[model samples]
Target: MSATRICALSELEQDTALRVEVEGVPMAVVLDGNGEVHAIGDTCTHGEVSLAEGFVDGDTLECWAHGSAFSLTTGHPLNLPAYEPVPVYVVTIEGDDVLVDPAVTRPTN
Candidate 1:
């Protein structure tokens, strides 16, 4: 599927995460302090909690339940309890809109 408009760019706050679901796929949309947008799976791999309800430190989103920090770029957990990685979606900004395709994911290394 092609990218779908999830939210407006103006709706996002720096270093904060917003939970969004597109076509039944849940995601966490984050605007980092550096002014870049990211889309990753919202479910924490360790605690199965919402990552959007967690904390954003730089490019990492830390799960509030277990403290597992996932890399915003790679989707890999950087701490204990969460060894699995989540899916990272491609983000496209058009005008004031933030678009994401739930069917599309970026290859992580």
Candidate 2:
């Protein structure tokens, strides 16, 4: 499947995460302080909680339930409690639109 328009780019605040669901898939969209957009699974692997409701530090999203931080770029958990990494979706930007493809994922390195 192709990328679907999630929201307008202007609607996102820097250093924060926005929860969006596309095709029944839950995702956390983040616009970092560096003006970069990222899409990852909204569910935290450690606590089964919403990562979008957590904290955004630089390129990492911290889980509010257990304090586990996941990389917004690779979706890898950088600390304990969350050994499993979330899925990182491909994000596309067109003018003022922010798009995400639930079927497409970035390879974690």
Candidate 3:
């Protein structure tokens, strides 16, 4: 539940997605277009699909199955078929390591 070390910060490339599990929580860690790290629920809200396997365009990750675009910071679905928002975790970088806290997430709206 606390901030757990997920991986090395160098392991993530800019604008790429990395699937990680912390405290049994499946998450997708992304280095966005601006080279900022973000953590969000890996599963798509609309279907049984992995968001890590989806497309990363800027800060939006589109579910490959239903094309549901979820905001990286807010985790809100930007389009249809997925009215619910995914969970966005808190990512902290310590030196060269990436830490994520699954217990902490952005407020859903």
Candidate 4:
């Protein structure tokens, strides 16, 4: 699938996540420590909470609900309270825009 532009790269701060809806899918767009963009499903695998509300440390996305952490690159669960992997998406930076492919699976942000 083709990537869709969600917002400008400058609009998102590093080590932060923004919740966005793409093609009716609830997703989170994260900016890592190196200013790279990554996308993933917003919902926490362990609950109905949004991942955007969680914290971002390096390549890890920590869910605020249960303190579960997931790798931004592989969608693998890194800590307790979460055993299932969250769905990850592909992210691309084109000039000033941040594009994301919600259908593609990715591990790095």
Candidate 5:
């Protein structure tokens, strides 16, 4: 598993997400409502839009393109037009840096 530093923890606001690229793979790093960090695929399963452009409510991340919602923890699609699950990466906060495992993402089923 290859890990890369994407951003600082302080760089992310609460209940918001940031889009990043790790080794050419698009990723969305989110700060949940509980203040926990999560990383998921930036692409919307419903279409070719980016998930980072969507909104975050609690632990659910919704795609702005089609309003498809997904679970940040399991990467499961929670709404229509997006039955297939998206990849979710493992995130670890070390000090102020956000560390991500590029090879450990959960693939869409």
Candidate 6:
């Protein structure tokens, strides 16, 4: 499937997330410490906060508003204050560009 270019890989640092919108869908593209890219919903389910503004540790992104932790790989909440799982998007790297497919989601494990 075709993926939309979110940002350049050079624009993202390891262990950080960059917020982008695809077809009006707010998405968070994360670069883990191990140099892997992950994509998840940008909004925190527990509050009106941005997950991209939160902290990233390994594969988890901790919501700054309610301290809820969400897995970047699965988009599942690993803690309270957020019982709902966020949506995950497909991430692709085309050369130096970071592409994301908001319509395609991987099954949560």
lDDT of each: 0.97, 0.96, 0.91, 0.86, 0.88, 0.89
For residues 1-109, what per-residue lDDT tens digits would candidate 3 score against the true structure?
5899999989998877889999889999999878799999999988968999998999999998899999998999999899889999989999999999889987866
Q: Which stretches of candidate 5 lie over 4 Å from their true place?
A: 106-109
Error of 2 at 88 (Å): 0.5
Report how far off residue 62 is in candidate 6 (Å): 0.6
* TM-score of candidate 1 against the unseen true structure: 0.98
Q: lDDT tens digits, residues 45-106, model 1?
A: 88889999999999999999999999999999999899999999999999999999998999
Runs in model 1 deviating more than 4 A are none
Please report how far candidate 1 places residue 45 from its true position, in Å.
0.9
Please write out the lDDT profile of model 2 over residues 11-97, one tens digit for every residue: 999998999999999999999999999999999998899999999999999999999999999999999999999999999999999
lDDT per residue (tens digit) for residues 23-109 in model 4: 888888888988678888889988879999999999988999999898887887798888888888877888999988777775432
Q: Which ten residues in a row have the lowest lDDT in candidate 6?
A: 1-10
Candidate 3 Cα errors over 4 Å, as ranges: none
For TM-score, candidate 2 versus 4, the one ahead is 2
State the weakest 10-residue window (summed lDDT) of model 4: 100-109
Compared with the true structure, what per-residue lDDT tens digits does model 6 show for residues 1-109? 4688988898998988888888888988888988889999999999969999999988999998899999998989999989888998878898999888888998877
Q: What's the TM-score of each model vs. the native?
A: 0.98, 0.98, 0.95, 0.91, 0.93, 0.94
lDDT of 5 at 72: 93
